[model samples]
Target: MESLTIRRPDDWHLHLRDGDMLRAVAPESRDMGRAIVMPNLVPPVVTHDDARAYRERIVAAGFARPLMTLYLTEGTNPDDVVSAHAAGTITAVKLYPAGATTNSASGVRSIEAVRAVLAAMEAAGVPLCLHGEVTDREIDIFDREARFLDDVLTPLRAAHPELKLTLEHVTTSEAVDWVRAHPGVGATITVQHLLANRNDMLAGGLRPHFYCLPILKRGRHQEALRAAATSGESAFFLGTDSAPHPTHAKEATCCAAGCFTAPIALACYAHVFEEEDALDRLESFASLNGPAHYGLPPNADTVTLTRGAALDLPPRIDTHGQSVTLFDPGHPLHWHIH
Candidate 1:
């Protein structure tokens, strides 16, 4: 097909760091219908007021609709969560499991510690977004996600059967199956996870650009992610997890983990679905499933992708005196949103 048109897509998970970094990255996502902004900043957005302030800044940057989230820290107030939901200030609350990812040092250390808050969210019909990876030092880095399924996610579902959850940036076959099996549970797959596996990070030498938390899994896992994303399943949808980090932060001795993918996210997703011969299902995965799962209406507008020239995008974006790298999908994309 030379062209495709679909409802404007929404990113169920995205990261726009505060201040200058926010200005540099937020505009790249402006074309999206809406985005669920992650709250893993240095201090993190732990209250309704913080989310409101962040939303204002995103709007100031010209992004149309920014759906904010509160960071679920051990100290998160259950009453505050209920009030936030009631006030319509947050779309969801993110649980990071402490050191699961970038700026997640204040994430919840134990589910028990946050049960009251979880219960509050469930009562208020607020969804919980999870960075589904275990932080147990004893667990192998590769096994953390799978272990998280058995040790944490599964139990949490049983405890709060009605609590809506989206396993953010899920990267394992195990997570895919679990989400598929559980009702009221959904998962968001990142563009990087769908396109690259572990080898892309360490095979021919370290490729720091491909490094990300819940780090890329094996090829079999990537295959599973592709199948789930293109299967036209409502439980799975697009979430770029387009986290941006300055070039210096990513190349350091103890490099940070994230792939700044906001710019080419949709194009990358198009390449994946086209390869699977599932172009027909791309809209459902990108634009429909997420809204259905979140109980929001699908966007009224549409975006057209014209397939004529190879997709050309900047390799890096410069702002705030630092450069943020863009994700290279490793294959030429002919689809360009018009």
Candidate 2:
């Protein structure tokens, strides 16, 4: 098909850092009708007031209608969490296993320590977005997400059955199966995970931009993620964990963990769906499943994508006195959103 149109999609997970970087990248996600803006800022958005202020700044940066969230920490107050959700200041609370990703030093060190907050969120009908990976040094990095499912998420699900949970950026077949087996649970699949695997990051040499938390997995996992994303299942949706770092940071000794794909994510997803021969399901994965999981409605408007000549966009965007590199999906993308 040369052209396709669907409801404007929401990014189920996104990261817009504070200040200059936020300004530089926020506009990149403008087409998303709404986005569940991540709260992993330095010091983190830990309270309702913090989320409110951050949301204001994000709007000021140009991407409006961001559904804000709080960064879950060990000392988080349950009342603060519950009240924030009830007051509509925050949509959900993010749980990051300590040291799991960038700016996550203050993330939860122990799930037990945040039980009160979790219980309060569950009781109040607030959702929980999880960075599903275990930080135990003994567990191989590749095994973390799978281990988290078995050792952390399973029990947590059992303990708080009503707590709405979204497993953010899932990268494994096991994760796909787990979310499928459990109804009402949702998972967000990132563009990088769908387009590239660990081999793309490590095969020839280190390609830092492809490196992300719950780091890219083997090809089998990549296949699994693509299948799940293109399956039109309600449990899976789009979350471009489109993290950005200055070009210098990404090319340095310890590269940053993310892909700066916010500028090109939708077109990339179209390419993935087309490759899977499931363009018919693009609207469901990109625009429908997310809202259903979050108890919202689909966007009324739409964006049309046309398959055409290879996209000739720049490989990087200048921002913050430096530049952020956009993800290069290896193959030339023949799609553009109009």
Per-residue accuracy of model 2 over 2-68 as CA lDDT, tens digit each: 8998999999899999899998999999669999999999879999899989999999999988999
Please give, for residues 221-271, the per-residue lDDT of candidate 1 as tens digits.
Answer: 999999999999899999999999998888889888999988888988998
Q: What residue pairs are clashing in model 1?
A: none
Q: In model 1, what lDDT does residue 29 have?
A: 88
TM, every model: 0.98, 0.99
lDDT of 2 at 92: 87
The alpha-carbon RMSD values of the candidates against the true structure, listed in the order shown, are 0.9, 0.8
List ranges where model 1 is wrong by over 4 Å: none
**Model 2 residue 249 lDDT score:** 92
